[model samples]
Target: MIVAPYMLKAFLCSVGLTWMRSRSPGAGISRSWARALPCKPSPAGVAAVVGTAAVPPCCFLQQGQLSLRGGLRVPPCAFSTLGWWMVGIPPDTAGTSSVGLRAERSPVFACSPMDLSELLKEGTKESHDRAENTQFVKDFLKGRIKKELFKLATVALYFTYSALEEEMDHNKDNPLFAPLYFPVELHRREALAKDLKYFYGEDWKEKIQCSEATQQYVDRIHHVGQHEPELLVAHAYTRYMGDLSGGQVLKKVAQRALKLPSTEEGIQFYVFDNISNAQQFKQLYRARMNALDLDKNTKERIVEEANKAFRFNMQVFDELDKVGRSLGEEAQDGGVPVHDGKGDIRKCPYYADKLGTAGPSCPFHAAVGLARQPLVQLVLAACMAVAAGAAAWYIL
Candidate 1:
């Protein structure tokens, strides 16, 4: 009769434990003995077999190695195998057997050094910081967003996603980009269209036009999709990952600040209905991106393209800020304030370094208002001049 490998290993382990208990007084099986069972071959291509009275040539005992007959010896195993099980404990000479084995767990799937997901994240961190600090983003986070600007922003997103999704669809069949093509779960064009309709009425198509900044972004996406399809992964990773990470926070801010209905109108762009677990979906997407068969140069190019995507987003934000300034609408006060109980302005998502420190109430806006004042500007300029003069004098 043939026995399975695991079954054979189990039987050997049971026999070995019984023999050890009978030969050595007070020798008990350690909890780790189960994991250390010789189920697979060691690194030297030798199977660690347990036998009675005599052991194979591969099994020998030195100082602290496992032994079956006279002395305990264990052959070297792969790092992966060592990660799975603990090393065998040496027998005690004082008539007592105590097992000391340390268990270490290793990653199930070993990742390559040049993982695409990790590369993109580290490369775009600076760009991400700059994007978050944009005046338009800060205002939106503070619930100071105007309705007209918000509608315009939605229009921009609609056009941008329209172009991106079209390109993604075109390249879905390509091997290099096929694995990352998640149409149903990651696509946002349809959702953004619904948001546009809610904001611009049924004739939303006629009323909304793509801003120049958004047009530039759309043009780049189309170019990438048509000419350099491999680079499409960068744009996809930037937009989709950002949306999944911060979409809910932005949605709540918009809904509260705009006084939109609780039924989730005007913010469908942020609502990912198809994605039940956004975090898990993001992890899956990252894994797919990392699994793509791209060389080092292509990975670097992708990272560069992701930074360009961030720049495009920043330009769109700047354009929106300009339009918002022209509208002369009062900032809405419906945004949820992020604080650390001490009313720390730094913790506020709206806080930017250029906007100066916080004030007693609504510090971000207060700093912005103060900076905009002619007197405050002149005072700041004078202080800067005085500091420069002091430094020059000291140098001289």
Candidate 2:
């Protein structure tokens, strides 16, 4: 029963986390927070509904609740600063969500490097000062990694540290860019202003719409998408490049995820042969962009759109948070559907009689089918591309 000092510290920390979550008394909502690229003004009632909130990742640990869709509770934990990526799974109801109290503690089994985040936290001001120092940045990168051998260590550092100067200070990559110069201040919603009328039947404030500047950001992004095609292809490449074979790395990720990585990852599903001459294919992609002849302003516009994708995503979560919170409150009242947990798969014939369900045109099924089409086509196209490349290689 006698605990050591360190053990005592940890025990108290866990106790402390529980205490923090339970702080807001009166029937805790089963809320799930999301980890995202960076902060954005949430859609009104996000945090209030589930009583769950998503905070940006920091170097030190964080304490909060995160919910996957459909209610899988994510206990807070120490995670990497996405450097700016949202850890975002866009707003799809298909993902899981959970609600409960949990510690923002690091897992024991994960083989992680020393608390580099903690180290960086201590040096945040200093590192930002040296934001332009390539040598210091390289040293910082080398110091933060773990590898079995030096050669492999170099490779990890090579990939991880590729972008430094720009990330630290450039407007394009900095997490704080959206807050500055957009005219409106950073959105920090009040706890109760969440009950908007649409999601909650209460008389809500006129929805605080995205500011005009934000709209400009959105318009610029879409405009670029149509006029400058590189962003689309670049985004596609960025989306598909990982775990090409569903190799060991994915298998590892799959293990940690209660749902294992499985074969669904990477380009294994990709029919494209590994590009031996990546330059040539890149040249082809570049040619496509060049042919577009998108003006420089237009090209930048597309990149801006790429940026808005993230901003818009957070906006949705913000709104969903309101809806989700209201629903959680409703569930607390009487929203739990009493079935064998089997949904009325079809609309309740009763509500349907009154409001006419989209019946045969169950939009959900249609959307699901439509979503799968592009993916199937992409795979087949990649396969065809791979086969043609192989054939050409053999002919040569």
Candidate 3:
């Protein structure tokens, strides 16, 4: 049967994903256990040994050949990237060695256990703190931002979590997702929906719109779900973990700043109803992540994807900051641009000094003159305080 490239890619990716998940911690069998089983070289030499009979035609056409783990002499095209992520392809000299092709076992998987959760925490600590200390974020934390701006931030989050949760549900049956699929425990879509109603009122769905940054973030989650669903693991780790950790702090800040009632009305998005102990739950979540049957390359890719997820969030913050700034400006007034095309969040005087970059010039003088107005002065003071605090935050 003829298949389009996208479909073929998706099919292969799914197969690979399934194959890898089948070896996860709770999955019936594991690689170490399977290695002890008896096996025979294929009659067709290396090709037959690798289960070439059940292999699809696309595998042969797209890739050269499949090499058995033992010493089977097959073509170079043992697996495509999709399959590569699924079933590991033997090295080039796999079968040529006197000992046949042996699956490359990761030290973390076999010998030294690695705490993926701790690694993520340590790897992302700086960026995570920086994001929290951004001028826009500090304004919200200090309750200095307007209710409308705060609502807008929630709106953006609504779009993002919607995409992520929907994709997770769609791919839940996949083995790679089985261990991590805690819809009751980690799902935030319904909570975010409640927040949207509280902020935008009953007609929230009709009125809410995504910013360009929010849309980009949504598109990225969808793209990964469609093409490389395995990477969703990383996205989940980046977002949900952050939500469970720093999100708790932000929840308290928001409730106080927004004067939200001590109920689920406004802060529903941050509440974890099923999880009584956030720290304990986080440990469980990390255990599932570390238990995933990912090879070294796949693990590396997951880490990279997590980093990308953080960068995506920073971009969303940048977009939100622009919207907040635009709230006070005159029709033709152009405020100082903060972000460059690159994803650097600390590009302005406030953040630049924090990052040790020379501060930008005084283009905001014209804008500051308008701040002399009564109502504008209050906001300007808050902005200046937020900026100075954010800059100093990096120093200390």
lDDT of each: 0.63, 0.27, 0.57
Provide the clashing-pair count of each candidate structure. Answer: 5, 32, 6
**lDDT score at residue 75, model 3, on the 0-100 scale:** 34
**Candidate 3 C-alpha lDDT tens digits along 1-396:** 232344445545544555555555334244244333333222343222222221211112232343333343223211212222112222232222222223331111111224455455556666666665666765543435556777888898889888998899888766565557767777888898899898888999999898898898899999998888878998888777667765665565566556678775788987877655454355445645654556677777776777777778778877778878888732221222232212223321111213223233244744654544444544444555555555555655
- Could you tell me how far off, in angstroms, the CA of residue 167 lies in candidate 1 after the best superposition? 0.3
Candidate 3 stretches with Cα past 4 Å from truth are 1-113, 328-396
Instruction: List, residue by residue over 1-396, the lDDT tens digit for candidate 2.
Output: 232344445545544554554432211221111232222332333231111233232222333344322253333232332211112121222231121112122211111123222222232323222331233222212221111121122222222212211121233222212111111111112211221222223443342344333344345434434444334422222122221221122223222222213443211212223332222222222222222323455445444443343333234323333333343221111111111211221111100111122122245654555544534445444555555555556655
Best TM-score among the predictions, by candidate number: 1
- TM-score of each prediction: 0.60, 0.20, 0.54
Minimum summed lDDT over a 10-residue window in model 2 is located at 179-188
Candidate 1's C-alpha runs over 4 A off are 1-113, 334-396
**Candidate 3 local accuracy as lDDT?**
0.57
Q: Write the per-residue lDDT of candidate 1 for residues 1-396, one digit (tens) a residue.
A: 133344445545545554554333222223133234433332354333321111122221121222322242323221222112222222222221222212122111223347788788678878877877898987776678899889999999999999999999998778678767777667898888888888888999999888899999999999999999999999988887777666566776678788788888899887876665554355445645665668899999999998999899999999999999999866476545333222222222222222222222467755775665545555565565555555556655
